[model samples]
Target: MSAPGNPGAPGLAGNSGSPSDRAAQGRAARKRVPRSAHAGWVPSLDRPDPVAVLERQGRDRLPELLPIRYGRMSASPFAFLRGAAAVMATDLAARPHTGLTVQLCGDAHLLNFGLYASPERALLFDLNDFDETFPGPFEWDVKRLAASVVVAARENGHSETKAHRAAVEATAAYRTSMRRLSRLGELAVWYERLDADTLLPLVRSTRHRRRAQSTLTRARRRTSLQALGKLTEVVDGRRRIIQDPPLLEPAGVPDMAALRKIFSDYRSTLSEERRLLLDRYRFVDAARKVVGVGSVGTRCFIVLLAGRDADDPLFLQIKEARKSVLEEHLPSGPYIHPGHRVVAGQRLLQAASDIFLGWMSGPQGRAYYWRQLRDMKGSAEVAGMSPTELTTYARLCGTALARAHARSGDRIAIAAYLGGGDTFDHAIAEFARSYAVQTTTDHTTLGAAIAAGVVTAAPEV
Candidate 1:
């Protein structure tokens, strides 16, 4: 792992050089690695099998849950892409990068950008998943976003031309937004955020605006109190989380005891004020929960707490943290604990984060992070989006990503590297289109493995 001076660590300060000198350095980097060089994606002959990569990932995860992850990934090409971060990280590591570091949402696919409540209770739209976040070149995130866009567009039955266009427009938005943010004061960039309420005005059509408003309303309604009736039941005169096999189940006596112990450990990581506030909420119930595509096999649980009365509830999720998929491919990050790495990365990348965010070590020395389970969280329905709507959403995601990168990366250098041209955007479009094809091929390979009984896959749920 990298030591104290590494830029990948949390609390990274900005480049010390003057703006003009940084800009010149960015320009100089172009001679060694031109922006246009990102145009193609020809898979190497010795590229590891995608299924083998997934199997290797599952080795450390829950054995029974591995089938669900496979089942989820096999549902669609986009689903495979969502669950195949390790595959993409390997491919990206082989490509030329500009060497400009940023705290990456290592799995920055289309669905990963969403709406969630900030600490101040304002609904904000930004990157919501950070399981694979690590420091790497800025273009890695852009390429991942563009590739997901292209894959989503194709899945929506758009022509290849339209898919390519959407990817180009997304990268273009990232470039333009970065350039605009480069001129902003440091504090202004740090404070920038996308308010969910303000997004209604940006929707062009009446139908889309209504959908946008509906989404916002649904997000606001997704609080822990709202989830209480659905996720819990009054059992034998006691309030407890409902047990549903394979998805949600009570942790047995041993696991429950471990959870209770770690619950206290997690409290120590919070601020004194938060610790005091948490002390008021008595622990009520906890259940293992399966969440997300790529994160499916990891150990995850939801703990319910009550304040004052049984009516007032709080749901906190404790998710297992492991070495990032990017770690092996890139230089090691500074964090020794995976949970600390995830929590620190989230704080560095998001505009405003969940106040309940904390981390601790769990049983068997596994690292885990704790955060609210359902605090106004919602993601876009990418599969149903129209071509125009997809393009607009792409722009929103691009802008949000740039705003995040600006906080931890050398935006002036990245903007200068992108220049005032469409070269990088077009290059990324080409790469996305090529990668989308590779994703489909890999998806087929996984399906073939399932058919041949080489791997087990649970029925789609």
Candidate 2:
């Protein structure tokens, strides 16, 4: 780690480094890692089998839920991409990086960039997932976002031309956004955010504007108060989380006792004010939950809390946090605790985070993080998006991603590396189109393994 006032430190986006110095460093990086070198994808001869990679991840996860993970990944190319971040980590490690560090989202796909309520209760669009977040090359995340755009475009039955164009525009948006941020002061950059209400004009079409408005409206109604009616019911005059087999179920007695201990410890990590706010609620019920395509099989629980009365409820999720899949490929990050790594990375990268966010060691010393299960959170449906709609959403995600990276990385350097032209954008778009093909092949392999009984996959619910 560099000294506190060191101007040349890797991640000093603005505080210590002179504007010209950081900008020059970014320009120098382009020579070592040419913008054109980022194009295309060719699997190395010894590339790890994608299914085997997933199997290894399942070793420490719940065996019963492993089938759900495999099942979800086998759904479509876009679904496979969501679950295959570890596979992509190794692939990105194989390529040369420009060494511009950022607090990466690790899985910066289309679905991961969405509308979530800020601390001020204003709806903002930004990266919502940070399970694999670690400091590494900025372009790794850019490449992931670009690839997801192409995969989603293809899955929506769009032509290759449309997919390629969407990917290019997405990368271009990132580059342009970064260049704009490079001129801002430290505080201005840190305070930057995209208000969801103002995003309609950026969509540029009446149909897309309506769709954007609907997404924002849905997100606003996703608060805990709204969730109470959908996720809990009165049983014997007491509110309890409704049970749904496999997907949601009451925790075992032993697990329930352990969760109480975990929550108690997590509260200690919060600010005194947050702890006081939390004390107003009492733990009411807890249920194990299956969530997300890639996150299935991980130990996850949703705990219902009540304030004053049963009608006033709060839902918090405690998810087991293992070492990020990026750990093996990237250098050791600052955090030794996996749960701390997640919480810290999330705090640094997000525009505003959940007030209830905290972390603690679980039973058996396993790391886990806790946050609101749903706080005005909503993701766009990428399955049936038209080419134009996908392109617009892609651009939105790209801009959010750039804003996130700018917060932790040297925005001036990255902007300089991107230059005034579209060279890097075109390169990553080419890479996205090529990687989309690779993802399809890997998705098929998972399906083949399921058919051959090499792996079991539960039927989609």
Candidate 3:
């Protein structure tokens, strides 16, 4: 791994010597490190042991981290798989690479791609996770994504060939789109996005179309009012969050005295203009909520604000920021604060973002990014999608991923390296199939561990 403060290195394309210059420099240094220098990119599947690879990656902290909750393995093997990202990441890092670097969803499994409403009310399709986003080999994303396809396919009873084909189709789309992007000018590439409507035609199957439509409908309905209706309920004259046990624990309202002090500090984190604007809205309620599979244990809070009238409401989700998993694998610098990295990466990748998207360092030195809680947020039901529909969704994800990569790097050079061929497609397909098999074996290992009482897996909700 490249060390921080390494100078005299080539930078990412279009960096222009701004504050992003150092990040560009770091990416360049990483690229120059020969694949042999890093045991993480081993290509031979048969000789390379996946479990050993995972152990090596987590060797620094494996025993300490293993006792963390393994949620609901008995319900379905897939649930255990969802919580084993650290194990998978280690395994994945030991795989072959196409050597193309981009900002990656380090854990780009099938479930991570989704539809999010932009500030303009336009629903856009994109990668939804940034916790692991960083400059890394493009194949890392595909390997993780393809393995997920196989896992989902196994759960849905699809054949190995069918799952492999879907993963190939997705990989092909990414290659083709990147090649096409190479021919375009920088501004055009930066502006490119795969929106929901544009993706509908590619879906093809009637069953898939119906599922996509249903998800789109639900996402549109998740406006602020809808979120408020679903999440908040009045209890004994005070608005309290409806507790859903471990899934959605009630966090009780913030102590008025504590909030009054914290709000003042929070205000300082905002721009003077946003601070003044926020002053108009009085804080009404706050609650702790557990959300998502990987993020379940992280401290996440939902704050309710009122703007002088009972009808006027705004909801915000303040998720705790922890160190990125990428930090363990890569040498990140002081210039790269995780919160700022997330916000910056989101802006670089997403065509549009929530207007309120911003970050702050808390009183305890914790970092967090704030955004609207449920402003038209929605995601595709991977379990319900037909093979054809999955293919289309995968293509859309690939195209979007390519566009995001083009934003920070030299598309022309990267595309030239790709060379408009199926070499990458075939390689990714092979890797995906192999990795998928590995995921199943690992899932089974986790199940065995749970059954033997080696780990206490959480009960199904």
Candidate with top lDDT is 1
lDDT of 3 by residue, 290-405 (tens): 66655555666777887767567888777665665555544452335666667666777777877666666654566666778887778777775667666676777677777777
| Residue-level error in angstroms, candidate 2, position 432 | 0.3
Candidate 1 lDDT trough over 10 residues, lowest sum: 1-10
Model 1: per-residue Cα lDDT over 1-461, one tens digit each: 32222233323456879999989977886875699998989997888999999999999999999899999999999999999999999888776677788899999999999999998999999999999999988889999999999999999999999899899889999999999999999999999999998888889999998888888899999999999999999989999999989999998899899999998899998999999999999988899999989999899999999998999999999999999998886676879899999999999999999889999999899999999999999988899899988998998999999999999999998899999999999999999999999999999999999999988999585
CA lDDT, every model vs. true structure? 0.91, 0.90, 0.63
lDDT (Cα, 0-100) at 70 in candidate 3: 49
Candidates' TM-scores? 0.97, 0.97, 0.83
* TM-score, cand. 2: 0.97
| Full candidate order by lDDT, most accurate first | 1, 2, 3
- The runs of at least 3 residues in candidate 1 whose Cα sits more than 4 Å from the true structure, single-residue gaps closed, are 1-13
- Model 3 reaches what TM-score against the true structure? 0.83
Error of 1 at 300 (Å): 0.4
Candidate 2, 1-461: lDDT as tens digits? 22122222243233457889888989998877889999999998989999999999899999999998898889898999999999998888877788788889899999998989988999999999999998888888999999999999989899999999999999999999999999998899999999988888888788878888898889999988998999999899888889998999999999999998778899999999999999999999999999998999999999999998877889999999988888787667888989899999999998889999999999888999999998999989888999999998999899999999999988998999999999999999999999999999999999999999999999694
Error of 3 at 413 (Å): 2.3
RMSD to true structure for each model, in Å:
2.6, 3.2, 5.6
Q: Give every collision pair in model 1.
A: none
